[model samples]
Target chain A: MVQEDYILEAEKLYVSYNEIDIVRNVNFRIRKGEFLGIVGESGSGKTTLLRALMMLKRKNNDIKGNVRFQGRELIGLDEESLRRLRGMEISMIPQNAVTAMDGTKTISSLFHETICMHRDGKIRRRDSDKLASQIMEKMRLEDTGRILKAYPFELSGGMCQRVMIAAAMINNPKLMLGDEPTSALDVTSQLQVIQELELLKSNYQVSMIMISHNLGVISRIADTIAIMYGGRFVEYGSHEDIIRHAVHPYTKALLAAVPDADGKISKGLPGLPPTFEKEMKGCPFASRCEYCIPRCRKELPEDVAISLTHRVQCFRTKELQDDIA
Target chain B: MTLLKVENLTKRFKKNGETVTAVNEISFSVEAGECLGIVGESGCGKSTAANLISRLQREDEGNIFFEGRKINGGFRLKPVGRELQMIFQNPQDSFDPRDTVLQGIMQGALSYKVYSNRELKEKALDLFSYVGLKPEYQNKKTSELSGGECQRAAVARALICEPKLLICDEATSALDVLVQAQLIDLLKKLKNDKKMAMIFITHDLPLAAAFCDRIAVMHKGRIIEIGEARKVLKSPEQEETKKLIQAVLPVR
Candidate 1:
């Protein structure tokens, strides 16, 4: 693909809340029609990174970063401009469906509002209704008319989530940001939602930046994976590279923690991640790293280039590899 | 010997003049020192069955026999609470937030009047070590500890009473992956060391397969299938169980 194919880019991003950094020096790029996965445990700043990319940080939160969409700056843009760009060029599917959608508004009303906000001219209700049915049909949503008439509370969680997806896609944004989209869903429902997302990605050619704690869910959809820890990207690579050869200790620990269906229990990492409030000088994972040396505690490890597509931040990757061999 | 026998257990809740059957005639047995895992999705009634077995809720129709003694047939039962204990999903709110870890565990033993004040304190200290908690956490309030530590405190409280059966109702669901592994290992060790029967209830089939000796698959308030962990997980006979297994991520 050509350089113009890249749709979104984050360069040396630093986001903080009330002078406390929640995401630090992060960098990544998304190509047009490509799916990128950001995986981490809770408090790992995955959500913060997504919010920062969307310029949706809370009041009093300081963001020192550059987020470019189609080679244009998005950080210093005004609310009105951002709002205009949102739902037209970019959209977001928030983590909490219950809170993201209005309980009183019918699914149809929400869809109508979203479509009208992005549409250039005064569109008629019939046109909006037609658009809503089209997107709902693409999402495999059954009983579109009934769903549009009923309130959010009357629908099941799975149906509510599907409606939210429809509402986000009704505007046909180029880029979509999903935060833990299926974390709250059951296994069957999760699979169904994932299938719908896959269908949307292929049929609409929409690029996505998905944030999830479940690596399995990420593995199924993401083309590239970025592992974050303590507000930093400890590893970044293609999904195949990261899953097969994770060089960072934190990434390895996360992979090992996933339970296998063969009934063999792998011992997970021993300690928790470092607290964000505390000042740290060296490696953030040193306290929990089993192979931590004195140098690891004294110097922060730089991002070591393992391959053209794979990179890791770890001092003992080679040593760990030799031991494993 | 069978530690507990549950036969044709059923429970129904009346909500807004409509009857919702939670557990519809599910039957299973637990052998001494065996770990039985009940796997199902939310609202599948596995937790309801756990509550019924612990006697936390009254069953509409069922028979529960503990150590060959019938206890759930409308017979006025004595203090059977000491013999069967339950560990809830959220460990943080399971106990009094103001109480220390030691105080919580000691309260369990003290409320049963099983040990004297001094003996209870001593036993609480010892149980903390068994659950991988340090002696210093004895004084730390429940709110001060992390998720895994709070769960350890909860386990210590449940085990301090020396119950013959421990029912973990999604005890590890709220924990992170690493912390969940530690808790599962700790439970395995405790079951081995104490020779206690356990009912591990969870929705994660992979976790259940790892820790359980036998598995029971439940769907819509029914135990659809039951067999050895490997057998049931490898080739589930019921269609719902098969769909659940298929939905799970394949082991790498």
Candidate 2:
């Protein structure tokens, strides 16, 4: 693809908090209308990396990287420009709907505030209500009157999640960031929310970066998948490449741990993911990897490419695949 | 032999000045050493049923028989002791924060007054190893352990008294995939080794298919379908069950 065709790009990005690097030396790019999924265990720094991409700041955090959104650097942009770009061009759906929204405010009040803030006097109060109702309908949420009058606490988790998605789509932003959007919901509600997200992507051409811990959830929606471990991506490729031709030991272990839809109980991966508290010299996953060697414990492996769209950072990717097969 | 029998079990609650039927006249039975799964979405009254069966909640109208004798609410005045035990989704919140692993587990055996302190400690250690926890974990507080480790500890605690029926109420829902798999394997092993019957409640259809010998599909506080796991999965008659089966991700 051409450079101008890319909607977002990251070059050698690193994020640190309290002098400990949480995201290190990462490079990424997403084409127009592309959906990228990042999968990792808890504390793998995927959430931190997602926040850094949007330039969301935290206390005692330091970020160094080149983040380009539509050919403009986002790292050092002024607050006023960022405010204009946030809801208009880029938006986020937070991790949990229960805590993300205010409990005291009604759904209609929140929607009115958002529409007025984004449009800045261009849309009248009556039109804003009409627009909000239309977006809710597009999200497949019936009973608009009942939903609008209800508070966040009155709605179920799934309804609250759909409301969050509707709020995110009111402006029709080009990019949407979802952090564990379906984790809190049950199976049926999860399917509904995922289908709604897929609809948003297809009908509105909204590109997305979805962060999740389950590969099953990611595989259903993502076009491209990245397996993150410790503080970096262990493998990056197309969804097919990552699912069928996974090379990294961590990636292979993750795939083997998920229960199948056909009711097959998978042989689980042994041991827990390591906690990265300090700077490390070698690969962080060496302790749990079954195929780890002396060299793996002594030095970090470089990214080895198997195809144009597939790459893995492992010392013995080929041998690991052979063993698993 | 039938270990537990419930006939016309019903529970109702008042919400916003309206009487909602949380569980509406459900009937089921469990055979000795058999696992029965109750699969449903939220507000389907699966948890309420479990609570009523375990005597954690009172049913408005129902008949519960254990060992061919009618029993009232469990664990009170009946001296059921460890005969019935329940495991919840979040074990961390259920535990006392100040208690150590050994203390938490011993509470089960201590309630019966059947085992000496030394015997309980020995049994607790054996259970710790059986559930895949190390010996050192027995001394740590609940907050010090990870979510998976705490769940494993909860299982060990639940089995320490050697219950006849284990009720797991969405016990693995809060865990990640890897931990969920491990916990299921552990539960399967325990069921076979101890010959214990179980009432497993969950929202995941595939998981119920894999874990239970028989499955019951609940919707709107009613059991719409009940049969062998394979039979129900192969030919689901209820629209709710079909929708749930379709929602599951296709396993590669």
Candidate 3:
């Protein structure tokens, strides 16, 4: 495939907060209209990785990355230049719709402001009304007139999330970044959000990088899944590789921890994730990894390619696979 | 023996000048040392029903019989504090921000005046270990602990009173999947070793099906489905329950 075929590519991406490295040497290539789901426990830096991809700013944040979006380098871009890409070329949906949205503003004005930001000028209220309702219809949020007039507090959390999705889609960006977009929702609303995302995939051909702690949701929706442990992708593979042919012990343990759809929970991983209080040297999962050998604690293994799309960062990958097979 | 029995339990709140029947005449009985899971969405009256049973909120109309003694609106005459305890969903926020988890638990236990200072400390330490926390965490503030650890602390706090009937309202909802699994294992062990009855309330249908002996699903302030976990999973009676079961997409 040509280089242009890839929508976004990352090379040796590293991010640290206040001199403490959180994301390290992450590399991946996402093709057009393909979504990658990143899963991890809290403090695993999944959210940090998403923000670094978009160059979102925070106190004492540092990013050293080579990100190619449509073959254009994005790491060194000026703020003004990056602003053009955001919400137009790349959109982000936040974790909490209720908190992310301004409670004082009406939904109509919120949409109007989002449009006005990327368009570089003021937009007519009538045009915002038309555009907001049109995309809201696509998102399956009926009663547009009422919803448009109501504040964020008035609408339910699910409705606010769908409205946020609609606002993100207003410019028809090529890619979307979501941070647990459906985590705060109930099952019904979560299914609805999934349906909306599926619609976007089919209708608009939008690619996404979504962060979720839910294994079930990620496995169901994501084309390629990346399992993050202690700020790095311990295992990045296709659904078949990670779920069926899992090589990393942490990935396997994460799967075992979740109760199945029929509600049968198996043996659990005993210890908690590494707090990273000591000097970083070996695999972050070494503390809790049941099959951890002496070498796993001494050194961090390279990301070994088990297949064309699957990568496992563990010294015992082959042995684990052989045992499973 | 029947540990708890609710007959015609109802709670209504006037929200925005409109009367909302949060829990509408829901009735169920829990046996001693058995887990009863109540599954529902937000505003489905599961939490309200729990509050009514735990005496956190007064029921508009109902009869709550605790161990065959009617104790609703009459909790003062027949105090069930030592026997009945409830844990909320957000244990982190439920705790006092300034106090350590050990202090909070100790204070709650102190309300009963059952144990002396030295025995209370020992029992708190014992309960802390029982809930799967290390001894050092006893002095740590609630803010320093993770969500799962804080919830375990909440469990320790609740168990300090030695409540035979424990009500956990969405206790594991805020944690990660792996953490939720660990907490589930802890709860199962507690049920057996401590001989405790639990009203495990959550919105997770499959979890309830797996964890509880009997499952009661509430919808729109009503009990839509109530039966054995296996029976409910095999053949659900209500459309709402069926939708909930279907809503859980299996992880491949």
Highest TM-score scorer: 3
Error at A182, model 3, angstroms? 1.3
Task: Give the higher-TM-score candidate: 1 or 3.
Answer: 3
Candidate 2 ranges beyond 4 A from true positions: A121-124, A320-325, B73-78, B116-118
Docking class of 1: medium
Per-residue CA lDDT of candidate 2, range B93-200, in tens?
878999998889877778688899999999999988888988888889988888888888888888987889999999988887877888888889978899899999
| Tens digit per residue, CA lDDT, model 2, A32-122 | 8899999988778999999998898899888898999988899989988888888778888887897988889989887887776776676
What is the DockQ score, from 0 to 1, of model 3? 0.66
Assess the local accuracy of residue B150 in candidate 3 as a C-alpha lDDT between 0 and 100: 90
RMSD of each: 2.6, 2.2, 1.4
Per-prediction DockQ scores? 0.50, 0.57, 0.66
lDDT agreement of model 3 with the native: 0.88
Distance (Å) between predicted and true CA of A18, model 2?
1.8
lDDT of 1 at B164: 90
True contacts kept of each: 0.42, 0.51, 0.51
Best by lDDT: 3
- Per-residue CA lDDT of model 1 for A1-325, tens digit only, reads 3646689989889998878888888988888899999988878898888888889869888889788898889999999888898888899887767678888888778887888788877777777888999899988898888988998888877677878888899888899999998877767777878888999888999999998877778888889999999899999999887888777878877777767677666776666777777356788888988778999898888788778988888888787656656
Local error of candidate 2 at residue B86 (angstroms): 1.1
**Which stretches of model 3 miss by more than 4 angstroms?**
B74-78
